[model samples]
Target: MDEARDYIRAMGGGLLIGLPLLFTQEVWQHAVLLPAWKILLLLGLAAIVVIGYNAINGFRADATIGEVVVDSVEAMGIGTIVAFVALLALGRIDGGSSVRDIVGHVALESIPIAFGASLSRAQLSGAGDDEGREEDRRGGQTKSESEAGRLGPFQRLLVAAGGALLFALNVAPTEEPVFIGVGASPVMLLGVMALSLVVTLALVFFAEFGGRRHVSQGILDRPIPETIAAYVISLLVAWTLLWSFGRVDGASVVAITGMVVSLGLVASLGAAVGRLLVASGGEREDG
Candidate 1:
């Protein structure tokens, strides 16, 4: 019974995150135009991300890699079902649509939704406090507060990647990045990058956004190097997402850089939030 309720909550979260995209004309258009290979790649990438997220922040107690993988697959299934139903109800997909079109559109739409489902325990449940205490006990930590600073670099990077991908997924299919790129000068783009870095630093290091508990002491004490590394990762994620959505194809080098910069700002914010989430054992909001 509890398991069923949890799955229901996860589905609800999936709908909350995915319904808007189901109705988006741009999303539909992208589904139609994006090549099959790209769609396949996106699905595979989403599975990997879901698995990484589950391994770090999922619901199972002392979950092994195999358990995490199973949970990730289940989350993907929930996301796909939610996306398909929403698309069908909204009249965005019809019986007339080809199998490839239906599959592509649903697959792309499911990535973020699946992510939200995978994150439902953290975002929608009140059990995080209990889980944290349990973890502290298992780790032989006498102080509950000190447990937050122990996450390794690899875990932090995975969280950052998850956050970057979640944020970039929404914007990658839109024209906003390209529009901003067209209007902004090189100096303006540089300013944007600087702002992204500053915001990321503030959120992860200075902001009291419930993440201080999980923050690494090394990062909290000397944050510059880690912040720079995370910012670079965010840019790489943004660029990859843009490419996956066909946003960078045929664009000039300068234009591609601008689009990446524009998108990187948002992706960096997501990365900051992700770092905190991972640190907090995935108890924070998805952002």
Candidate 2:
């Protein structure tokens, strides 16, 4: 009964985060057109993310490695079922669709949904207090907390990159980035970049969004340096994703840079959220 309840909550959380993409026309298009290798790679990457998330903030506390693995698989399964059912209900998946089409579409869309499912405990359950108390009783920081503090510069870059990728993937296939780039002047673009940096800093270091905590008290936790570093990472991720989607294939350097900056705004916001999500626990005062 407990397990069933958790699954139901996870499905609900998945739907909350995944519904927009599930109905997105570009996402559906990508489902049918993305290459097999890309699809497979996405699935593998999703598994790793789900497992890593489960290890820290999963529904089950102190979950063993084997248990985290099982839960990750189960979350993916739940995400798949939810995606198929929603698509079918919306008439997006008709009976006339081929097996390959149906499978590919559901499989591709399931990755994000599954990731949301894996995050249900942290995002949906409102159980952080209990979990924090448990960690305190254990007499030291949990494994996730410990590791978050010890992350090197490269790891911080990777965290920002992953966040940018996850968020950028949602809108990259759409025309919004292109449209934004086309309409904005150079001055406007510069304003947008400044705004993105300010917002990223506020959210990650200054703002109190749900009493969330920072992972480390190191140099990266400082507003100026972390903001600069994360913004750079976001730009890199935006550039790479844009290139991969062929959005900048024949574009001029200025055009490409503008598109990357436009998308980097969104990616920076995502990086902030990602930092909060992966940081393991709530704010702690210096003792």
Candidate 3:
């Protein structure tokens, strides 16, 4: 049936087109694809990127299902590749770095890691794009606040670090976070904040450039939306890097890392639910 064919295209777009490109690093990391530990970790990271891309496309539910998948795959793939290229460009890791080293450094060892930087931009950008589309769909939504692509390094760090810290401390309200209430010194917290700032900015720049290339080539559904998705994908993919290095400073940093890990779990769960709804023919409110 034509409908079945369409679904095939959608799955194909995401699985075939996106997976290979997004996991070139993974392929290099595990050419053998043996032992569960070897391929599973990297593949898992790639899976998150795939789902993150879908979430971005989910914002544009009016688009055809197959079309959305294709766009999502393209966006995610661009994000994964460019984040690495950014690492190299930034000289944090050389192209010559072993696959494991590059994966460890870029995805898990870096300060904010690629995920926080990319996701912060994506969230801001998604909010704008969603707001814009909602306005056009409703024909009554405000245009004053729907501007897209305005996320910057400082803002991303604030969102990721502040959000992570706030979420973490909120989970277990203790004297630690509340010390700020007493105007306590924040030397350690400030360091984590600074590290997050540096990591997030680098990811944003490279990922954005790669996403833009797809937009220019007419490979994506839309520039703004795809860019947002790419950013989210970058965030999810970079989780490994964030976790690997996050605890080097001790308790406070580890706590913040735990918060981010928790948040990633929540975000991933939401993505799965969204996919299920879409498969069930649920129309998105914004779209």
Candidate 4:
């Protein structure tokens, strides 16, 4: 059960950070354009980053060198699979795609995904650092006291906006959202919106991530309502980013809505994880 949960979290983290880049056309082109040596170099760099990150903040609290290497390899594998599947779902690659194109696309995109997987325990979970929280407990801080340090409702919304922007900003300016929005049917857009909300709720509440104790201490704290509120923030942020990027300019309402929903999928995940991060940090400071 524990290992299953860990793998799920790792997959979630990879998607959370990697989905934006999957939508990028430049990334798709990079796969075929870069020389083999450069591609190998990029892979090496990604491996080094994953290995170093595991050495520092891996899923386990205490991992030996062998363990870290194993963890890094697993993260890389998970990331590669995530990239391949996501690209396929987005229709970026297909059965018709050449071997070089497929390999380049998957390998290039997996770097960030693996990095995100490696940071799973730190970034995706609502839980904070285990050792730090344990130290706080030993320091005589009560649970209620820790909860009191959580961001207020308004503060959480603001942080959610910031997080949404952080994740969606780069992708928003690109052509992918427009391409997706224009091509997708109304049903597809609705599906995207639904998935975005589900992802948000899962990350913020159901993931059993660390620092969850500090999540819902504010006035508007119920799970469903709060998730709705965060989703709203993500949508608003997505709309704003699209408008600013001129992607929505002179567009029909249907097209605009599609674009917003497509980008909101990424932004909503950011909002969910962002609230957790800030809540954890605030608790630690108060403790």
* Best model number under lDDT: 1
Per-residue CA lDDT of candidate 4, range 206-258, in tens?
77454454344554776778889999988987897676445676999999988
Model 1: clashing residue pairs? 148-214
All candidates in order of lDDT, best leading: 1, 2, 4, 3
Q: What lDDT score is found at residue 52 in candidate 2?
A: 59
In order, candidate lDDTs are 0.78, 0.73, 0.36, 0.73
Q: After superposition, how far is residue 9 of candidate 4 from its true place, in Å?
A: 27
lDDT by residue for model 3 over 1-287, one digit each (tens)?
85554333333332332232233343233322234353345445444544443443344344466765664454444444544655566565675766766765343212122233233333434444655676574554333222212223222222333233212311221232223322323454455334443443333323332222121333333334333443353334224333332321244644544434333333333332222222211122222
- TM-score, every prediction: 0.87, 0.80, 0.32, 0.51
Instruction: Quote model 2's TM-score.
Output: 0.80
Point out where model 3 deviates above 4 Å. 1-46, 49-53, 56-60, 106-287
What's the lDDT of the predicted structure labeled candidate 2? Answer: 0.73
Model 3 gets an lDDT of 0.36
Q: Of 2 and 4, which scores higher on TM-score?
A: 2
User: Which stretches in model 1 have alpha-carbon errors above 4 Å?
Assistant: 58-60, 126-148, 211-221, 281-287
Where does model 4 exceed 4 Å of error? 1-137, 141-149, 214-219, 281-287
Q: What is the lDDT of residue 71 in candidate 2?
A: 83
Encode model 2's per-residue lDDT on 1-287: one tens digit a residue: 97787888889888877887887898787778777676777677667667656665442355678888888889899889998998898887899998877987888778778877877745556445445567573476544444444445455555566577678878877889988876788999999999999998888777765454454567865668888998998898788667655689788888887899999998888777877565524343211
